[model samples]
Target: MTTLPQISLAKLAATATRREERQRLQMACEEFGFFYLVEHGIPKEQITQAIEASRRFFALPQSIKERYGHAAQGMYPTIARGYSRLRGEILHPDAGPDPKEVFDLGIDSEGDRRPFAGSTRFPDDALAPGFARSLLALQTTVLDGVVPQLGTALADLIGMEEGWFPRHFSPPTLGQRVIRYPARGGTCAKHTDGGFFTLLLQEELPTRSLQVWFRERWMPVPSLPDSLVVNLGDMLQALSDDRFKSTPHQVAHSGESDRISLPFFIYPDIDACLTSCQGRHAFRVAEMMLRNFESVEAGNGAGRARELQ
Candidate 1:
């Protein structure tokens, strides 16, 4: 078993109060670009339930799954929007299409009218009982516990008050993606997340393989119980004046059973600016991601672009 680096939030938070820990976290972000966060406040049962719900939902028949598809943005079952590979297009010319199918959910807000906003399609009792509620409950709990902490930590990393981020993320556009990667014959090609940060809870270990970009190389990120993997997106990297990095990563083909992962993406305010604050680093990250998003949507996947809002 590979013993990956671990950061106990309780200890890190305790150390953060001492200024030295704060420096350590900032350095970690700069150097590793990804980290395994332990002792995060979310309970074990909640995580388990979320995974269980995801498995149940994905296990539904394909005909039933398509009923909830978001055709406009390519959001639907077995298809990934923005991050999933195009039909018949290999993520890596050398590799096959990513074997993952996905369903996405966003914050339920009335009259928000954002590009990604709307009521998510839920199966009725005929399809599955209590499915939507269970999934939403899990989403709420995970976001409620993780987002604020991540925001505050990020603010501190940039020399701002811990509460500074909430001002921008108030009623944030929270998005949830339920992904199912079939056996290792197909895998996600190399790509970066489109949101500011991604919190992934793995339902099972990687049957094929999972890898993350770090220190200018692709390193395997092992799946462990009770641990969530955190990765900085392009926006964070740009906002930090390149202090933090949004590294590129991919999932390799697995010949065993399929893999499932539930990822909750936290996006920044769409209209937020990308300039430096109080002599801190500039906020060009969001802008960079936007540009990358557009390019990707324009059929130029080979270009190094970031995620879209």
Candidate 2:
């Protein structure tokens, strides 16, 4: 029974003397690649609002929800926003499709057509008032404040030159999802996040669903109402030369009642060229991101995960 390391974001953000907490973060990144981040400055109300809004959105009739469905459901063929019904994604191929429904959105840019960019299709305010605003407010706070501070700390741990990460990381491309795991279906299969890192806020019910790979077995990461669960992902693993692994984990929603979790994926500017730590090769952010999504969308993420690992 391994305990996921709990690191204080405030301590990590402390001035020059923050080395101790920074080292702890590095250790967590190296050993477990997952940790509970406390003191992360997100308001309790924002979280509550998002979760409540998600519940309302999901509780709507199927016909009403489908009005905002992905084109595959026969909406906008070019965009991949809005609602996706149950069994829509299979993060781990072996376990088959996930028994989950998801509503996804990125930063709402009016007409930007770049990959993972452009305006989001949100449910009307009359239906779910404050839904988009609440989620985006939470995201904006994290992205603008906590995310950069944490990234700088990690960069220091990895010995990246000053300003290296920020040089090409302006206005990062991000995706946020409000995901629901039904009470009866199987778990979200084992898989690692595909971005630089992820900010996860798990709903307060069924507190024992998330587990991470550690020391040759699955270890539980029970939910803590006040903290965010952070984890390393493939991009960071690549940038750090595998020093920080993107640990594989899965969800096994237990007991009765539905479970919802929000995950915010962070990526660099699409045109940025990321050179490996060892300078082995450089790749464009857009190509890497598209390949990651395309593989999963095509149900071949298991193979892609193997390659990245």
Candidate 3:
């Protein structure tokens, strides 16, 4: 069985050792475009609590969960920062809406009326106690560390200047989705992520559900103990001018019980203009992200697979 390469986030994030680890990280990004991130240093209890809270949220009555549904509150179709009900989001056009339910939260902002920017719609504490806090705490900690450090490392891999990526990401448009894939329904069809990169903590199952297209075959990615799976996204692929790949992946769950996975998507600020890592022409972050958001929601996929061709 093929397993994803394990990259030590501790070493990759360390300033002294990052230079040494960059070659390995780059190889993983280019060859597999994904890896298992070990020694990320997030507390075990925090990961447990976040996953438990997410499970509890999904167990809630549909009516209660819909109280914070994102579609109604979002200023634009692209804003999906709240609870997204099952079968409401379409990631792969052929598979239709995924049978998974998701609750998303991003960096809190006040009065930013643009798409993908605004205060998160948090559920009432009474409705789902600790649901908000646990998830937010996990997301916050990851953002504070990997969102910057890992991002910088990726930039360096593509020859981006030191500290240049952070400038555009000052107040990044990042978000984490706590997803629940129930027992009965269609599988999560093949699709590439639409952002810059993703940090995922998935439940280890007897049957592998998460897979990546590699060497002309779909390979299952095992869930390792205390490790988060990291993958590049299309935006980063474009930024790297395909020097890095945004590998296509999917979930085909055959398990009877519900599964919960936490995936954090990292991207630059909405208003930031991003170009190729080689300093080519640029496009506004908001436009591309919103377009991606709309397409993914509408089951059009990220539509960035064309970049590879």
Candidate 4:
């Protein structure tokens, strides 16, 4: 029944005494593994345009969208890029497939042969004008602008150098995804994200159905307008030697109209290896996705639990 903490990026930056902010971030990561971010400096207009552009893209005919589908174009090997239809991805074996459609894009490169270093498939000019530009702008803002600040705060909490966390993301292997769940009760089964963190932007609708597993129960996450919800991911949990939890969360079908969400996964270089100072354990970035996929397919019960509300 505890509400997620709301942390102000501006306050965290300007405050002379950062001890409180550091403690708050540490506790949130250790306990809830989720929080609301405010005043993060990403323009509201950019966020709005990104959402509107996504709406236009999804409104296109199913056939046109399929032309750019991830599987149709063999984009699965890159981890996640291009379009995926509803039920295309099964993140939880016990909960079945997720009833959602998503368009994914990741760091673009030509020379790097890493698992996730590949070009994104953008919509053609005939589909939606400026769609690629708007989406890219929003993605860059969060990755370049918002992430560094949060990363610095995280490093401070852990007693590492200020920029230690963000430096690993130089030429980051991150991904941006825009998803739509039509109708109510479209469950995105309980699971943890596979990267370092996730920043989600959701439209404020009649129903906000995101739930986080906490304190041995499922808890509802309020949908606040003009705010981004940030959560820890599996890689971070591993990096912290399980000190920072990667809380499991799921999206229950909304009983109202369609629901749209934009979630960006923060990844490091494919070869980046994270070692916890406390536990002396090492986690490779490249292997985390494969490990997570296997767990989901094998019905691993590590992050899964009863969702009774």
Candidate 5:
């Protein structure tokens, strides 16, 4: 096992209640770009069951999996359909094509009605017995453990009321992606997350390297068991006036074995606007990031770069 950084959520959560601790969390966010959350309240069994269900779904035949393809909403099973593919322009240009297949889900909010809106689908109960219920249970537990705490901490970091973020997220729209990477050599190209925050639950340790861009260099992030890797996104950076960095990252192609990962991306309300310390610009940075990400995925590298800049 590789050595990984340890962050005490208990300490961070406790600090969130106090002004000083809030400052520390904000400082860490600005400086490090990422953090490890430990002792989060999600149960171990729930994570395990979800992982098992995910494995079963991915093992299905490609034809069977195609039943869920949702290109219109960017949901369903697909390989590299949500981001750019151009060389030297896509986030991970140097790395080879990402040898992975993924199923993505978006949460349902007000004015939106869709099954598994803001969530992913497992094989139906008949296809994989107990899969749907077990996965939903895990999702609920994980969300209960992290969402409130994360929102509160973020609110505190911005010196806002504890419930400030919650107001904007009452009907939060989360994106969950279950990814399966083929055996070594198919690595994810370098790129930054397009949401406000990401919580990655790794089912199996990755044999390929995972690197994060920090201080203008790619630094490897070690994978640890039973821990979720959390990363900030561009919305946070915009809200913080670039104080909180949104680091670029990628997974290297592995040669030893295939890999699986479940990442839950937490996003704000669709219409929510991002402002700064003075609350001057009420622009919707989150939506913009999403738009740019989609453009890149559609092979509009030049357009995406312009929007990003």
Candidate 6:
């Protein structure tokens, strides 16, 4: 009967002494690896608008949605950065084909640039007005405010100087994905996020889908309105020498209706090197992504093989 903890960013921001906030965040990162974050400064209306826009996009004809696919018009085929149809590819093949559709976008360059930085594909304004704007606004909020605050707190927790973690992100590599999960048995299989961390904005639609690995069992994370789920990622675990757990989690069928969520995967600069207790391994962001794709391909093949047996 383990439960998730909710922490407020406002308290972490305004308080003179951050000892308690740092300790709490560190504990959550070490123990649960996931928590509910409130007062994150993103307007609730903007979140609602983003969710509604996702729903509208999903409701469109499959042909129309396919126009934004990776092979469609203007999308980067090197990475997972475009519209993917339901069961199009298995990210986690252990649970079989994923019963979900996703639209992925990477960092929209603003002056500072990186290899994978670019604008996102979007439908015409007549079809989906304000969709791109709302999504980008929310992403900007996380990049400008929330992520750096967490990074600062993390530096404090790790006994580093105030700006250590934030300074590493001179130009971050980010990807935002809007997902739609249909009412099926399994939506997404268990897996760890493949970045520094994630800011998940999920709809509070009376669904019990998201579960985290805790106490050697899967524990449910309740959906609360106007809040975001902040979770650690594999890179953080490696950077901290496994001091902070990047726990595995999965999404199941809501069974009531389609579920939509927005997850902003935040990463450090592509060329930044990470140091851990093990040693200093130069982990490039693009290389890590390539490994993930390779794993997915292997897993998908293994899944098909097991199905034959």
- TM-score (all chains, Cα) for each model: 0.81, 0.93, 0.93, 0.91, 0.80, 0.89
Q: What is candidate 4's lDDT per residue for 1-309, written digit by digit as tens?
A: 377888877777777746677777888888899999887898888877888888889888889888787655445353367887777766666666688888888767766566766677788756776678888888778877888778778766655566677678786677788888888766677777878789998887657689888888888888887788999887777777778888889889666777778998887777787777676567787787656645544545223333322
Going through the candidates in order, what is the number of backbone clashes in each? 6, 0, 0, 4, 15, 0
Candidate 5 lDDT over 1-309, as tens digits, reads 123345555665674444565565676577776776677777777777777876687677766676665543343223222221212134443433456777665553334333224334345787766656765676677667687777678756755665777887765657666666667664666667766678888754645367776665667776676677888876666666676767666777464766667788777776677666767434674456456556555544311133332
How does candidate 6 fare on TM-score? 0.89
**Residue-by-residue lDDT tens digits, candidate 2, 1-309:** 368888988898888648899988999999988989999888888888889888888888988888887763222223347787788776766667888889988777776767777777778789987788788888888888788888888877877889976875677778788898888553778888877888898776645888887888888888876989998887888888889878888888874888878998877887787877688546788887878777777777632354423
**Models sorted by lDDT, best on top:** 3, 2, 4, 6, 1, 5
Query: Which regions in candidate 1 have their CA more than 4 angstroms from the true location?
Result: 1-4, 12-21, 72-96, 204-208, 253-255, 278-299, 302-309
Clashing pairs in 6: none
Q: Could you tell me which residue pairs clash in candidate 3?
A: none
Native-referenced Cα lDDT, model 2: 0.79
Number of the top lDDT candidate: 3
- Write the number of the candidate with greater lDDT, choosing between 3 and 4: 3
C-alpha positional error of residue 143 in candidate 3 after TM-score superposition, expressed in Å: 0.8
CA error at residue 72 for candidate 3, angstroms? 3.9
- Candidate 2 Cα outliers beyond 4 Å, as residue runs: 72-80, 302-309
Question: Model 4: which ten-residue window has the lowest total lDDT?
Answer: 300-309
C-alpha lDDT of candidate 3 relative to the true structure? 0.80
Clashing pairs in 1: 78-101, 184-254, 194-307, 208-254, 238-285, 274-283
On lDDT, the stronger of 5 and 6 is 6
The TM-score that candidate 4 achieves is 0.91
Q: Output candidate 1 Cα RMSD.
A: 4.5
